[model samples]
Target: MSSASSSSVSAAAPASDWSAARIAEAAAEIVAGEQLPAIVQAGHPVLRTRAVAFDGQLDAELLDALLTIMRRTMHEAPGVGLAAPQIGLPLRLAVLEDTWAADEEIAHTRSREPLPFVAMVNPAYIPVGDGRAEFFEGCLSVRGYTAVVRRPDRVEARWSAPDGAARAAEFRGWQARIVQHETDHLGGTLYLDKAEARSLCANEEYSARWAQSTPEHAARALGF
Candidate 1:
């Protein structure tokens, strides 16, 4: 199977950096149409429920499979992040990547640096300071629109690496928002739950208003 057209959907910067052939390879596997794990929606019984930790060894195959499914789901839904719980997996894991970058650059020949596509396992976030920003946020599970949400501008987090090593990192700006959004999913919360009452916007309106907002503004408007 040929890789799905990188042009047809948003992808992480790393995926954008992949050569057409490389994307084709991955897309072939995806286009063959493996069963999509269930994506739990808002008001679903399990979506509001917390997920369990992944207790087994962190082997390469497991990591690859998780990443593959994540990429596929993100492509199919054209979403920025996905959680195992959203897929009905009940595991405390999620993937977050920059789909917007792919949309912006797919037509160009220049290769950009890979955005670190995160595979967080049993992740935890610790806010570093009192700084807060609002950004527009959309969810794969919620579908159809985005909402203004406020979130910390920066965060310190600890997560298990694919190789099972614990690592600590600091994130700010868009990266921070992405991490927070995916983390919320693992905890059985969606951005809709956190969005301020007046911030909700139809998908088209949010896109038109926020398509060019600064990272901070985007985060702020979304209530990140």
Candidate 2:
């Protein structure tokens, strides 16, 4: 979920409960032959639970099905990344992709770039250095909001691919942010834990007031 504060939105109930209705609705569609999967929101028990590592499930039909559903769900959310806990599954799995083709403004501000879709199982990461950067972040699970968060500027991640091949890679820029965000889900860490609470706002409010602003600008304007 987005690093946005949970207090920003005044939902009917908690976000998790309210979003469950939509998730159930999505499940109903799936039962009716729709392939899209539902996305669970923040405050869900699953999101707070640390995920289990995949054992020898690579060859299992269930794993294959889950990956398929997750990919479809990621694309349907129109988000660049997703984690299993965001879907009511406390599994250490995540998927990510970014065409890095948002309008020039966003692309440059977030350091976006093209990256092929990747599915990582039981991923882990380490900071590459003392360098840090702050950016406005968003998440599909924490819908309709964004907040400024500070994180290491780069990280090296190790994980098993969907095919069961072990791999490790260093990431930087927006790509690093995406990796950090998704992996955090596996550890039951939500972005809000690192977010500047005063910077939280609805997506619409963010777009109107801070979309053109950087994290530094937001901090100055919002007093975070």
Q: What is the C-alpha lDDT profile of model 1 across 1-224, one tens digit per residue?
A: 00111001112111112233433344344334558555667767556656555555334675567667866787677666677667655556677666354444421321212336677777888787998866556777776767667778778878887667897898876667777777877666677776776667677776676644433455566554
Candidate 1 lDDT trough over 10 residues, lowest sum: 1-10
Which pairs in model 2 have colliding backbones? none
Candidate 2 lDDT over 89-194, as tens digits, reads: 6567888887634667766766667768888988989889898878788888888878888988789999987778999999988888989899988777777778
Cα lDDT, all candidates = 0.60, 0.72
C-alpha RMSD for every candidate: 11.4, 6.8
Best-fitting candidate, scored by lDDT: 2
Number of backbone collisions per candidate: 22, 0
Name the regions of candidate 1 deviating beyond 4 angstroms: 1-33, 57-60, 102-114, 208-224
